[model samples]
Target: MIDYKPVSTPMSPKPKLSLTSGTLFDDPSKYRMVLGSLQYLSFTRPDIAYAVNKMSQFMHRPTDMHWQDAKQILRYLARTLSHGIYLRPNAPLALHAYSDADWTGDSDDMVSTNAYLIYLGSAPVSWSSKKQRGVACSSTEAEYRAVANTTAELRWLTSLLTELGVRLPTSPVVYCDNVGATYLCANLVFHSRMKHIALDYHFIREQVQSGELRVEHVSTKD
Candidate 1:
């Protein structure tokens, strides 16, 4: 839509994206092509990540509503053509990660969405927005899984930097908003209910004890 009016937001806050939200689009190929382009654009524009992840779920069988959302994202991109992420050359040489999850946010499935952002000093270096592989029994379980994903990324970054002969200013710290998940990572408590996630528990605990990473809680508002 060359002349389409620009929108302020990529997605509507009232109704979140769902696979069964609307009727099937007439031409799914066209929808796939547009969505593919948008996915490529998200490499630099993280603001549309959540919305893009939602739309990506319907790529196999996109509907008219999905197409509408894609158009809305286009409008948003149009409105902010000049906006871009700029990494500074003189930023500090430290690593930090922030992770968050939406518990069972999918309407069609009970799966959660896990998202994380990794920063080297002051600028973002890596980030992810993906649906969890399995259903979580509780919000804490979902949040904890997100932490594991972020921690894995942290380790990779650490090893890469070390190979380059780069020493970080401090140990990498991971921040999560869920108190229960944060405690699970930092504390040595082993409850019966946590047995299902024993592998994740051991993985993170090993990192904490070895001083490879640190997990802490942060206010959601932060």
Candidate 2:
């Protein structure tokens, strides 16, 4: 839609899509081709990452509704033709990340979406937006899982930087929006409540106790 009217957002806020809601698209091949291009575009255009990820879930059986959503992303791209990630020269060597979860975001599977964005100084270096492996029992559990995911990414990035002879001035910090999840990262008293995710609990707790990472809560408004 080169001349189509541009949209302010990539995906609609209401009427979340489902797996079996709409009639199957007649042009499945074309849908996959456009989606493939969008997937490549997402590497440099994080603004469309979440929308692209959501559309990808229906790649195997894209419906007309999914195609329309995909086109919405294209319309958004039209409005943001000049937007892209810019890594400033001599940016700080420090790393910080923001992690969040949309609890039970998937109406079909009841699975939460875990997302994290890692910044090396002012530029985003790594990011992910994917559904959790299993349904979360609570919003705190979803948020905690997101933190654990972010922590894993930080660990790898730290090791990579160390090998490259780059030492950060301070330990990496993880900003999460959930108070319960942030508290769970530093306190063992919440262990009993999170026994189901014992591995993630211990992994993040280890980093927090040893001062390798800090998990702090921030207001969602921020």
Candidate 3:
């Protein structure tokens, strides 16, 4: 236990839903059925994510440790039964995103994680927090990749809104904390330093130049 410290969280209190796990592996007519329900609960409770992911790794074996984790998760739910995200239906719609990367923050693989979220009047309608698929030689490269992913999500959400008759302005603003990446998206200028990034990542540049998307810079959170 000393080798693995529990990750600390700074979350405040909130209301959540209650759920029950069926049983242990014995007399398990509905073990898989129960697992399906448990899987969906991950949508709201990020607290048990690490434990659930770890328990899933040993599904074929059904080890004592896995069942222990399941019961412990139930106990945790008993205590934290009132915590969740909430959004009201009457709020106005506003689509905007903030994109960023960790800049080689991963100790395991040295690949920085890309994080972004798009909001509709303060509620997060779309969000992603993922490690880059490939190594980036510079912070600029990682940031550019993050912005590309964010741009894709923005386009998809915009199209969905249009179909739903939720009218949006001409250009959606995507904020990036990297100036170099912002410039790259708005230009075809061949800087000797950034020639190594994939050509496909440059696709956002056309979108930027055409006034379909706008990239602005912001200061990173400390």
Q: How far is candidate 1 from the true structure (C-alpha RMSD, Å)?
A: 1.5
Kindly give the number of clashing pairs for every candidate.
Answer: 0, 0, 5
- 1-222: candidate 1 lDDT, tens digit per residue: 769999999887766767777898999999999889989988988888888888889999898888998889999988999988778989999899999999998978889999999999888889889999888889998999999999999999999999999999799999999999988886777445678774754698789888888999999998
**lDDT per residue as tens, model 2, 86-177:** 99998998999999999999999999998999999999999988899999999999999999999999999999999999999999999999
Whole-structure CA lDDT of model 1: 0.88
Candidate with top lDDT is 2
Residue 22 in candidate 3, Cα distance off native in Å: 32
Top-down TM-score ranking: 2, 1, 3
Most TM-score-accurate candidate: 2
Please write out the lDDT profile of model 3 over residues 1-222, one tens digit for every residue. 223323333121221111223234562334444445666786665455444543453455453434545555555666566876568787667678888887875443577677777777767676666778888998989999999999999999989999999987557778999988888787667545788777777778887888788999988872
The deviation in Å at residue 126 for candidate 3 is: 1.0
TM-scores for every candidate against the unseen true structure: 0.94, 0.97, 0.65
lDDT comparison, 1 vs 3, better candidate: 1
Q: What TM-score does prediction 3 earn?
A: 0.65
lDDT of all the models against the reference? 0.88, 0.93, 0.68
